[model samples]
Target: MKKIDERYIEVLDQFGFGLYTTTAGCNLYHDSSWGSYIVNFNGDDFVEMFIGYAETFDPNEYVSLHIKSHRVIKDIGEMLKSAKEIQILLLKVAIEFVKISKESMVKADV
Candidate 1:
């Protein structure tokens, strides 16, 4: 694992995402209810963001990008944009996931 830029933690921390280290990886950012992001680094220049679900370290999917300056790289710059990517990718995904999951349990009589 490469050293995680503090800016990543700085942004993610605002969203209840806590950084943890498991056998899976060192830069694991998890939210108890909103899924997880397993960050894989490449020689301090790039990263792969893996999104996990159901309280596990293993992610269901991923998106990769290169690290860039303030103006940003086209893809991941979104994550750094006032946390919008976190909201859309993690927070919003969690909300919709839970909603869809619970729909099956809804009482038909109600």
Candidate 2:
């Protein structure tokens, strides 16, 4: 598997989203929950981002941007398994939301 940083950058770049890191090493943005986030274990940094359309200006059109990243785990085989599992769960939920949104659009068209 690719390193976490490389994977993160690739995913974000592919989706055309920008990452903002705080002075304290946290990443902040809005997603499904408006405050959903993932934290980097190295520095306890967090990341979240999403895009939305303005109902007044573009009620019929919308844009979405998503970002996902993983923190480096020093002891992959031992120390941080639970953390990794939690991250995987979070990612799964995000993906499911995307799927549901797409399905809703299709149903609306029908």
Candidate 3:
């Protein structure tokens, strides 16, 4: 495992998160009741990538990527796919809002 800055762990804890290291490895827990997401340190040369809450947590869903190797997730194809998914989701939400606004306008005109 790579060495990370102490401030990184402090920042994680300041936000109701917890960090623990066991014989298995270091794991990051977002909340008291949530399962831990294992921190992978494969190719972080400058700053190590410790596990942290993804800004949002869904108890029902599992992490999509397990390995933290920079080469794997940082590849062009994977990045493109991730970006495409975000774009699709954004488009869907935008379309929904547009539909709602159009209905509201029609009702006002009537």
RMSD of each: 15.5, 17.4, 16.6
The most accurate candidate by TM-score is: 3
For model 1, where is the 10-residue window of minimal lDDT?
57-66
Candidate 2: 10-residue stretch with minimal lDDT = 59-68
Model 1's lDDT to the true fold?
0.42
Taking all chains together, the TM-score of candidate 2 against the true structure is: 0.30
Model 1 TM-score, 2 decimals? 0.31
lDDT digits (tens) for residues 9-60 of candidate 2? 4444443334455545534222322223333222431222221111121211
lDDT of 2 at 95: 54
Could you tell me the lDDT of residue 5 within candidate 3? 46
Backbone clash total, candidate 2: 1
Model 1 agreement with the true structure over 1-110: per-residue lDDT tens digits: 56555654554565555665544555535442223444542332222333343223222122222232333344443434423344365644344444543564585435
Candidates' C-alpha lDDT:
0.42, 0.36, 0.41
Q: For model 2, what is the alpha-carbon lDDT of residue 62?
A: 15
Give the true-structure RMSD of model 3.
16.6
Stronger candidate by lDDT (1 vs 2)? 1
